[model samples]
Target chain A: MVKSYVEYTFKNSLPPNATVLLAAPTLPIQAEGGIPGNKGIWAGILSEMTEFALLFGVYFIARAHFPQAFKEGPLRLSLFAGTFNTVLMISGSYFVANAVLAIRQNRPRASVRWLILVLIAACGYLLTKYFEFRWNVGQGITGKTGIFFTVYYYLTFTHMVHVLWGIMGLLWVIARTRMGAYTPAEHEGMEAFASYWHATDLIWLVIFPLLYLLR
Target chain B: MKAMTHKRTIGLLWLLLVALTLGGAFLGETAAPGLAVTVIVSLTMAFKGRMVIDHFMELKTANRTIRSLMRAYFYVVPLVTVLVYLFGDRLARLTTL
Candidate 1:
């Protein structure tokens, strides 16, 4: 069943080398759902999700023990900042997704434009986040303030680091994309970046409410 | 041919996401009742995650195993988080060994 699905999806779209890579023993073909980009990136995503799961576990545990703190914590946060950042992240993910779709449609120039939009949105997020942090510290809501602030800093900071990594990935892919390194039939780098960005966006979707809205 | 359809789908999905985000923000602000807010927010989280996974990630037509795993990830994480949010006290006590 898996073989048929893989063959059906890739027989026309993928080149022979990609087929071999897909069938490579080093990767878990069954787990990839058809190799959105490649195996290594999917592995990275799995690891990323695992790490966040553990972090969320700790968060839930802490929230349980200190429900009142969690309740009161979000009230102090800047919901405007959180909501703005959410819009930027979701918009970035949309651009990245469209970039992938554009590439798959054999429009490299359109893909590059979409990526430029992604960069804009990413920069917007970073800038908003920087100001948000400044405002947070200005209000004396540092990590050392209390357990709620500690958890808030830990989760959001970790996610910010991931977003930074994703920004770097976008830069790299954008450079290669401008050089015409990718085509509709073989744009693994674009798909990989899209997957990473979407994953990060999804993580923030969860974090926004947990840290900002759930008062 | 198919790409056009995919683009339309993506555009529609993007609009849906934006709507959900804004609606969620409004609900977060005005929803007086706590439990109702939590449940609605939790459901919205799960729905948004699923949309990203299925559409943005292009896993809608993925292989069965991969699709199932991604679906499970999107579903279980939010569901469990909501459960923990609601019953964290009981959970902490139950696990205190």
Candidate 2:
């Protein structure tokens, strides 16, 4: 009776050809194209880049109009802090990339370690930015100080806000990772987070030169 | 083995990025405000952005459409920036509407 029930279920669940297809290796939806993580994340990244591009347009326009202010602005700012933050950002991005690689190799423990390093580097960035902001405020360099300062503050602060969000996402990914939520085949969450962080880092690469090294 | 190779490649890329950042800083400190420094700095920006997009974001393996879009973004941004730097006055006047 039990064998009859099992056979009945199997025959009803899958057709004969369907059984063979089910046993075959799965294929991707599209033969030649795919986005890392997913399409949604890529769309978000494109939107983020678009927004920054508009901001950059405003910056270049202002700089073209007031070259002297842009020239003299970086002199007063702390080049050390800017450089330090740039290093921290790129280092963090490197670690995050390593984390992604580690997970893809099914080394969740190694991935977690890399992620921890990323968080450490991110903390370093926050600390450096905090001191830089304090120094700026101490020297009366606020958004209203000048056009250059306004652009500087606007760009860097918006970036910091994004980094803050990335940090939160990192913590969540770490927790999920620790719980074995992701495997070698299914780790889109972690990859998406890494993509976001890398995009932020790329923005800073442009900002570092435009704000601190363009004299 | 493949994983090790990837890690090594990422390490090398990171070192190169660091070198470029410091070199750009040095150039900014010493070079006069002119086309040379502007071009060098702009090129560095483009290179760094490309590395991040290709290696870090893994866009190298993405579909043609997504890859082209991202590549265009990195290229156009730096190009426009350099152009605006060199021809700011004319650009401003042209867009004065």
Candidate 3:
């Protein structure tokens, strides 16, 4: 049944070395529905969301407890770093999404270009973040500084870890894409990585205002 | 023609995201923090999140369960931020332990 579906979707001639990227363990193909990348990736996304939701809960409690500290924290932090990171994240997300779009149009080379742009943006994010953390420590604003700084550091650090994971996932996707491991008909891996990266970007959108913009 | 339309849509989304980020930053730095600032910031935050989820993640056409879960996260988080701003004292007293 699944084979017939695949055949019908791909027109019966599977691309050479086409990867069998199933949308779910029970669902072997995406032609049956729109599952984005795969069930596994969605599972990962859900788990990531849960972890961040807990962190966000912690953030709110701390903010409620120390409203003064929360109010004053952003004034001390570098708005430049915050805004720069936000732009990079948004641009990287846009690039990765374009990569997905490109591949869907069967433009593998264009997809690679878009993926490369995402890598550049990701590298920019890591560099700016490193400097931002250094600036914070240099200013004597550690986790123990106050409730607000504590929450800020914890949330940003947790987010940074996820971004690192995203970069690694992106690298793998880029390599696979260059090897022609993805096709318009079977590019679930690329979509999966793009989805994860976009999710990471989404979290940053929330974090930016809370930490830097809300004041 | 279809690819061009997709490209245009992505370009527009990216522009909007960038504009909102800069606009929010300007407001945060220049405007006094108050009810108005908080409301604007929270709404923009939610809007930015939705753009990514719907267009960038291409989850607009995704499975109902996954899409709703993601959308709910975006909505609830921003709404909670507004509530925290409005009732910080009450929340603090309630959560004191």
Colliding pairs, model 1: none
Place model 2 in a CAPRI quality band.
Answer: acceptable
State the lDDT of candidate 1 residue by residue for A1-215, as single tens digits: 99999979868787768867766544211134476777788888878888888888888888888888988898788888888899888889889888887776678899899999999999999899899999999999899988999999999999999999999999999999999999866788878888889889989988987888775
Which candidate has the top score in DockQ? 3
Q: Please list the residue runs of candidate 1 whose C-alpha ends up more than 4 Å from where it truly belongs after superposition.
A: A1-33, B95-97
Error of 3 at A121 (Å): 0.6
Interface RMS deviation of candidate 2: 4.1
Deviation (Å) of B20 in candidate 1: 1.0
**Model 2, span B30-73: residue lDDT tens:** 78888778888888898998888877777776688877887887
lDDT-best of 1 and 2: 2
lDDT of 2 by residue, A1-215 (tens): 99999988987888669778765634211124557777787788888888888889889989888889998999889888998899999999999998888787788999999999999999999999999999999998999999999999999998999899989999999999999998878898998888889988988988999999886
Task: Say which docking band candidate 1 falls in.
Answer: acceptable
lDDT of 1 by residue, B1-97 (tens): 5556667877898888888888888887777738778878888888988988888887776666556777787788778767887788898897677
Best by lDDT: 3
lDDT at position A202, candidate 1: 84
In candidate 3 the C-alpha lDDT for residue B47 amounts to 92
Over A1-215, each residue of candidate 3 has an lDDT whose tens digit, in order, gives 99889878885466645545432233112233388888899899999899989999888888898888888999989999999999999999999888987887778899999999999999999999999999999999888988888888889989999999998998999999999999877898998998899889988998999999876
Interface root-mean-square deviation, each candidate: 5.7, 4.1, 4.7
Tell me how far the alpha carbon of residue B78 in candidate 2 is from the true structure, in angstroms, after superposition.
1.4
DockQ of candidate 1 (2 decimals) = 0.40
Clashes of each: 0, 0, 0
